[model samples]
Target: MKSAILQEADAEQFAEAGFAVLPGLYAPAELAALLRTVEQAPVSGPNFRRSQEVFAIRDMVGAVPALWPLLDTAALRQLLGQLFPTGCQLVKAIYFDKPAGSNWLVAWHQDLMINVSQRTDQPGFGPWTSKPEGVSVQPPVAVLENVVTLRLHLDDCDATNGALKVVPGSHRRGVVPAAAIAELTPEATVCAVPAGGVMLMKPLLLHASNRSTGNRPRRVMHLEFASVELPAGLAWREGKRLMM
Candidate 1:
């Protein structure tokens, strides 16, 4: 059952499973506002990807300032407080949609890269890659460990509609080599989230999704939060610098 309040057990579950789902984080009105804002986003832009199966805005926070009103709320703050008692900042945001009839399939992988403002020759950070989205680099394991990703669904999602399949405790293994993902995963559980639900997870968790077998649109706003300070001379991409 989903709770309107974020309880301590939610934090405990997340600590153990590396993921937790809080259903109905957004009310009807809030979700409607978000959908309306999404309709205004540019159909084609540098940060937008409109493939046959997938449509995504890599920098939703920067591209659409109207999203903040719908995203920032007391409920969100409560959830964040339970997980990060000290503090945390929203470091990244991406919005993606799996349209009906979409055949897009994502392979099992850990989100090990982070978007940063500059390429600092830090001792541990390296293997930088630049994309239209932003400059990305694989930070230290500790930095990735500190990341909290909140996936808010704009439509109902289930195993039939490209819901995420995750390895329960894989995050504890630290960063797994991408080259060794042949097994995809030994075991997995489908993360079924309702429309307006929010699923929180660790960036290190092993996750993948299959092509949608059902005819439902799956849209999500992927938000990443972190409190750790990047090594000197590094900062998050623009619009992710705010504390929420």
Candidate 2:
């Protein structure tokens, strides 16, 4: 977790493969506590529609006191610092659950935009339009660059249970064309991880998941962070802050 270690291996992985999966990032008891919290928390948003396939609850860190320790852990903080030496702040947190018999699959895409607090013609922000789905079009590069995500796995993951698939080194190219991806290798690598492992990935990386054929469930706590700076008058939602 030292800066030297992270700079040598973790940062290299992020730059070359767009992600890094660090095993045993969380203790077994901690993982169990997180799962329990998710099971009891209120379900909200479109993420809850397919409870068996894809169920997500937001603001988990603030809701679960047990998880706050991870925020200050020396190893984790050092890794984050190495990942973003400039400084970073928590942007969002959510618990993602993929239950058995779940056929939810996410298509390959980039996390290139953010929901603005208000409408604006800001040059680096967006196409600036609202939609029924509540998602805005392409936001500025600065916003995307400031963001990073941590996906902590509470259960073992494998291809049978829809482990994440990502294109190595995809983040460097920015957003990839859908047609172009079809021609590239379907070499979707399976991210198999034991319980208590964590996967850190860039928001722009091309990643997705497949249906779960195994009887087990895949539970993950996703925590996203970004630098404090915002364009002009934009602001992050309250209670989203989880990091200094």
Per-residue lDDT over 1-244 for candidate 1, one digit per residue giving the tens place of the 0 to 100 score? 4453666787788889999998988887888899989988777778888888788887787888888877988888877776677888888888999998788799898999988997878888878998766699999999999999999999999999999999987889887887766554877899999999999899889999999998999999999988888866898875344443
Clash pairs, candidate 1, are none
For model 2, the stretches where C-alpha displacement exceeds 4 angstroms are 1-7, 44-50, 59-74, 128-137, 238-244
lDDT of all predictions, in order shown?
A: 0.85, 0.69
The 10-residue segment with the lowest total lDDT in model 1: 235-244
Cα error, residue 174 of model 1, in Å, equals: 0.8
Candidate with maximal TM-score: 1
Clashes of each: 0, 0
Off by over 4 Å in 1: 1-4, 179-184, 239-244
Q: What TM-score does prediction 1 earn?
A: 0.93
Residue 82, model 2, lDDT: 68
Could you tell me every candidate's TM-score relative to the true structure? Answer: 0.93, 0.83
Q: Model 1 residue 133 lDDT?
A: 63
